[model samples]
Target: MTGSPAPVPDRATRIVVVGAGFAGFETVRRLLRHQRRSTDRPIRVTLISPDDFMLYTPLLPDVAGGLLDARFVAIPLAESLPGAELIAGRVDSVDFDGRTLQVRNREGAAETVEWERLVLTPGSVTRLFDIPGLAEHARGLKTATEALYLRDQMLEQIELAARETDPAVARARRTFVVVGASYAGTELTAQLRALADEAARHRGTVPDDVRFVLLDMADRVMPEVGEKLGDRVLEVLRGRGIDVRLGTTIDRLTAEAAELSDGTTIATRTVTWAAGVTASPLIQELGLPTEKGRLIVGADLSVPGDPDVFAAGDAAAVPDLAQRSGKGADDAITPPTAQHAVRQGKVVARNVIASIGVGTRKDYKHNDLGLVVDLGPRFAVANPVGVHLSGYPAKLVTRAYHLLALPRGANRMAVSAAYLGDAVFPRPLVSFGLVSADEASFPRSQGIPAPDSD
Candidate 1:
């Protein structure tokens, strides 16, 4: 959507990449790498994302717990990738037949964008259930703002906990409950508990009696990784004084407590929900066949009926090793994870280039490369390269992986510095006051991409 290119960039050669998460960022990065090479017809890649930065969502909990600074999690888009047009807007809908996308600018106005190729890698959003009073009362840690809020709330909780004369009310104020035992929930609970411990220790007014509870309906933590890893994480969290409540759920939630299905209620002022993620509704706008809201795609990463359209990330249902091995009987699609998304982005970029005649297409394939979950600082669990690693070694591998995976320059250093700073001092607190639990409840919209005016 710009003035005619010097070579008129054949209308069919234009690609619009939506979302700037791990998958989208890698997609654009891989594309730019390819574009840098000499090509007969140059490709123009425009990236449309709500923010002009790629958020390091993996370390977000650290930010909340005061273990890292806010800036550590956000890498500006332009600085990360040189050639791609990093637009600061969001895509609203897709016109599959027209090969166009609709977007809303920061000003709330809508525009239509035509593309020769469209890659949707919008990624995941926080999931909500119908549990009473849960959405309104509990805060979310999915975004940077949520992290900031949780930090402020932690410090404020310490202050409030120290003041209430009634022991029960004070105990309720100090108790922090996190729901969901998946990676995000476990990591966030562990980190925040550490932060609370450190912050309380520094204040000296907060007591060792302060409580942290992590509740989930599943029988084990990290269920996505299977029972073995789940047991390991549960032990780690419980060892840190976190009450691990498995095979449980909050039947009712009040502003002050979560009533469990066991008929027992825990009084607490703060509830953090990291239960899981769902595909964005943007995929629904395509009016294409889908499985569980994710746009269904072929092995080549193209929509079955819409060749001009492509999708990856949590927004897509992609085949996995299990699926291909079984001849599509089980059709075990890869679950959503950063490891797969990064690889998928590379494949998607090549396929988009091939589709536009710049090269040949490649099918996407990758089994899990093992996973790393950092629980607090030196405590972590990783099955890296197929080796089960825990304690300091796992922590080292986890940090290194995230550092290497981060998109931009000096960000790795900045994040490392923040970690060091947190070690020496309490986590710094900043308040954006943006996005309430209510606003975040609704799924975000991806906007039409703007021309690379930057």
Candidate 2:
């Protein structure tokens, strides 16, 4: 009895991160860097995601418009995240009280992993509405697959239009409708217009025949960049022959047409729904208090009652301490943008390390660093550090900003080469027919659950 006392098992502190978007990827990278620098307490880091790569989503419009190859924008998690256990799985649920997660791996097998500390950065999905035919025909630019599919679909439609005997059918095939005049929708409209123009030149068709309609409920195109800059973007878009409809939105969508709220029905085969995004479904399933579908967390990103849990990015409603000077508490939250997400990721990493006794905790605070909108070749609108610029000068700042923002060196080089090639040569107009319509649908690509049929 004296010799047989059971040997207690020893386990290192486990930290698990969910999702591989900008926030999660950056958090994991920073955490590993901290771990490498310090020889302190032994801790195991694990990243669980359905994808094995971190997608550079800001460049998705370029991919959709055939400006860049798809592979270059994807950063492989396994290679970039050394010394961390990469689990290819989607977390189905989390037992917050028990400190365990129920994950369904790529092969659809259920597994459970315990975590002493957890970071939630599942990101956001396309905010869908109850409009008819939307879920069936509308697509988004959130994933690389969707981008590739959009490129192929556009080319295929243009090719089909070239041989069509019916003028009405041809017009419908060439028409492209994009909702949401914000960053993603605006950039996509500009790039796709360029793509359609190039396709028109090769087909010996009038570029004007290819119609582009950009819609938004907001009064201005991109209100985030202030009214003056937003007005400049509107001017550039309209000057380039895009139908920029402010204070407008789609009422319904169909495979062949989109019905606008203003009683206009646009006949089109493609509808890119870039309206906006809401936090991932997992946040709602947690049964916790949320502000506008995002988890409520302190300025330091820690969950209210759960000290071991932290959330950032679009999934978390992080207080905007930098802007909290005179605003109400409810109004002082960071807008869910890529810039904020990237900076928030770093803060989350630092705090997570501190929670495990490796360092001291710090609150997240950052001022607005301006915005950039690339409107095709030789045209852009940028406000760099509060100085507004338009046209060619803005274009230079926009490109440089992207190149610097891209994390991987290889990606930056590849993107730079693509830009140079774009300047020197005509774009190739061909579709490989790789992604099917069903495959690129929102339910399949962006993880939106199919609505219940009545």
Candidate 3:
């Protein structure tokens, strides 16, 4: 047996991580970095995601405006994440007791994945409520496909607005209503408005009269970004000719118009849904106790009553006692943000190592490192280190943070260069229709037969 290597184990202790978003990506990153292949039995980490890349969702607004390379946001799983099997598919459910997951493959076939330890980072989906006609008329900007679609729609609207001498159709094409004031919505509103405004000048017919309206049910823009920055964002949006509508929402979405609750029906064809996100339905499938559609876990990031099960990211309802629990408050859930997700993922990995007999388990704890909002080229709002910054400096910090957060180091230089290139020669305003103009109001397919009881 001197020359021959030892025979491999027939059954490996598998660790399956579902969803390759912020949580799943970092979880796998930590596992591979910490685990030593020679001394340790190969930890079979299988990551199940619909796409091979982990999308940096915050920068999706830049993609929509064609300011950043669309491919820059996606990190291919194969680039790193060694020893982890990456499967491209939608996972239906996980049977906790059986330690198995039911995932549908590329060919729409089902396969069973047995695991010793499971990390359910199924992430969140866009929350689309029943707004009348919105499903038929709106254009979403969530996924890469949606971003591309919106870009085409914007360019289409500009061209159409240019061709039309009709005052009504021209105005309709110019007006855009964004039904959320969160980071995604705010950034999209600012960037797209800037892009369209520039295009309008070049085309001559597309209006300098182009308008954008950012609406939210909350009293202030970016309610999560705090009142100070929210006010600044409101100002920034308004400064860019984007009408900031607060404490308001769309009452009805018609084929050619959006009727607002404030008795304002904007005649427009574009409505971007960036209101919020809800946890994946896979969490409910576990038959485990969940807090607000997220798996309820202890500080250790492990599922309660189940030793092998773990959860993180937007899917996990992490308790926030540090920043939340005040004078009269009871239990408070952590805000579903990327900052929390990244920190929680590492903690999850450490805990998983403990489960695998590597080291001691540690609880997830993160002090808030404030948020940054990218509002087009030179305009941005940031509250880094609890210090408020607006205009240009904030934009610099925002871009830098995203560059640093990107999965690959190569992407950093490339992303930075593009930003510089845009500063020099702006990207030509053009759109290729990828996702159809038929907008989607619902997050997932309607009447999917309850996803099958299997």
Name the top lDDT candidate.
Answer: 2
Candidate 2: minimum summed lDDT over ten consecutive residues — where? 1-10
RMSD (Å) of each candidate, 1 decimal: 4.7, 4.8, 4.1
Model 3: per-residue Cα lDDT over 267-303, one tens digit each: 9988887888778877777778888778898878888
Q: State candidate 2's TM-score.
A: 0.96
Clashes of each: 9, 0, 0
Ranking by TM-score: 2, 3, 1
Colliding pairs, model 2: none
lDDT of 3 at 165: 94
Q: What is the lDDT of residue 362 in candidate 1?
A: 76
- Tens-digit lDDT string for candidate 1 (1-454): 2212223245326889999888899898888876777477578888988887888888888887777777878987776777777666768788777778888877888888888888999887667677887766776766777787777776676677788899998889888889898888889888888877776576664445678888888888886555777787878788888898888888888888899887899998888888877787577666788887687988888888777778898889987754577556566777888888888898998898888677788778786678888888568888886787778888889889988887765888988787677567765544454545444333332221112221
For model 3, name the residue pairs that clash: none
What ranking of all candidate models by lDDT puts the best one first? 2, 3, 1
Name model 3 segments beyond 4 Å from true: 1-11, 205-207, 324-330, 438-454
Tens-digit per-residue lDDT, 203-301, candidate 2? 787889889999999989888788988888888889888998888888988889899999999999999999999999889888889999999999899
Per-model C-alpha lDDT, please? 0.77, 0.88, 0.78
